[model samples]
Target: MIIRPALATELPALRTLETAAGAPFHDVGMASVAEDEPPALPVLAASLRAGRLLVAYEEGGPDGGLAGYLMWEPVDGATHIEQVSVAPAYAHRRIGQALIDRAGADGGDRPLTLTTFREVPWNAPYYARLGFRPLTDAELTPGLRAIRAHEAELGLDRWPRLCMRREAAG
Candidate 1:
């Protein structure tokens, strides 16, 4: 799949992709997650406008539509992965990894950070395989702390979560 900036008109399609991406959670006993609302369209629009959003599409696959997406924020000089989603149909294709790699390149030599469910197979462990390491509580930067707080406020604290970091390659 090719990763590129998202077009403004494709925001709704992204919401659909988000829904499909979250469906696997139900199979893993996280039904609430499957039912959870994707980021609001306004939020997606803002991210897109800020050049923080990227979508993946197959070059000559089934269709020309998007297969996945990733969104990040420049937080404290690092690219903080706010969200990443790949359609279940396209799972295991390394689309998500490609998005992460793109974000790392865009971030230059700055670190990359993200908060995710600790037990999810494709969450913390997957990132660990890609060079990320779990951050100790003291290692949590202020921006990451704030992100955790917001996630808690949204009831995501019901599951074990951790902040992970992939150090910049010098």
Candidate 2:
């Protein structure tokens, strides 16, 4: 698999990949999440233009060969991962991790941060294995607090969630 900045023409394919990735939420009893719409095309396009959308591609496959994708942005001096999704067919592979690592590498010395379901197997626990540590409410930076608040407005607070941070790899 090769990872690179997403191209403008690949935006729609990434949305499809996100839908496929969200399907697993059904098995985890988060059917609402499974049925939730992928990010709007304009939102994704903006991320792509900002150089924060990275995609994993199979070398010789069709349909832009998207295997997975990650979107992030600089927030409060850290690289805040807004979303990361790997197609079900590519599950268990390290594509997600690779995309995150690439984001960190691109972010220089800033730490990497994200908000995710606290108990989901592939959410907080998976991030923990990747060296992220959960932050208490008091530990949340202003930007992170704002992000969490927005998530609450979107009903993501229906499930337990928290912010996590991983220091830049030395």
Candidate 3:
């Protein structure tokens, strides 16, 4: 698999992957947006314009289609992982981790931070295995205010999202 910067044309695929990833949280209304179109297009376009989106690909058996993607933004003193998803058929292949590792490598001069639900598997403990530590909301800096606003607009108010951080290797 290869991880690289996402192109504007890949927005649809990235949105598809994101919607699939949100399935696990569907009962909580996580993927509540209309399926008629991928919302990531506008966000991805804006982020790419700002130079912050990344996509991952692997040669599908005989087909050359995109495999997965991750979107993030660099704010304040950290890189915030906006979303990471692989096609439903491509789950369990470590594509998510590969994209995350790539992000860590590219996050220059800042720590990598992300917010995930407090539930099992998607929470701080899971990321701890990858070297992230949970941080209190009080610890958030002014740089992350915009991110917090976006998350709020998404209606992710249920479980307290644990803010995890890891120093970037790059």
RMSD to the true structure for each prediction, in A, is 1.1, 1.1, 2.9
| lDDT of candidates 1 onward, in order | 0.90, 0.92, 0.71
lDDT string for model 2 (88-129, tens) is: 877898889999999999889989999999999999999999
Between candidates 1 and 2, the one scoring higher on TM-score is 2
Q: Which regions in candidate 2 have their CA more than 4 angstroms from the true location?
A: 61-64
Model 1 alpha-carbon drift over 4 Å, by segment = none
Q: Estimate each model's TM-score.
A: 0.96, 0.96, 0.82
Which run of 10 residues does model 3 get worst, by summed lDDT? 31-40
Q: lDDT winner among the candidates?
A: 2
- Candidate 2 achieves a global lDDT of 0.92
lDDT for 164 in candidate 3 is 79
Candidate 3: the clashing residue pairs are: none
Tens digits of per-residue lDDT, candidate 3, 139-165, equal: 877766566667677765545666778
Candidate 2 or 3, higher TM-score? 2
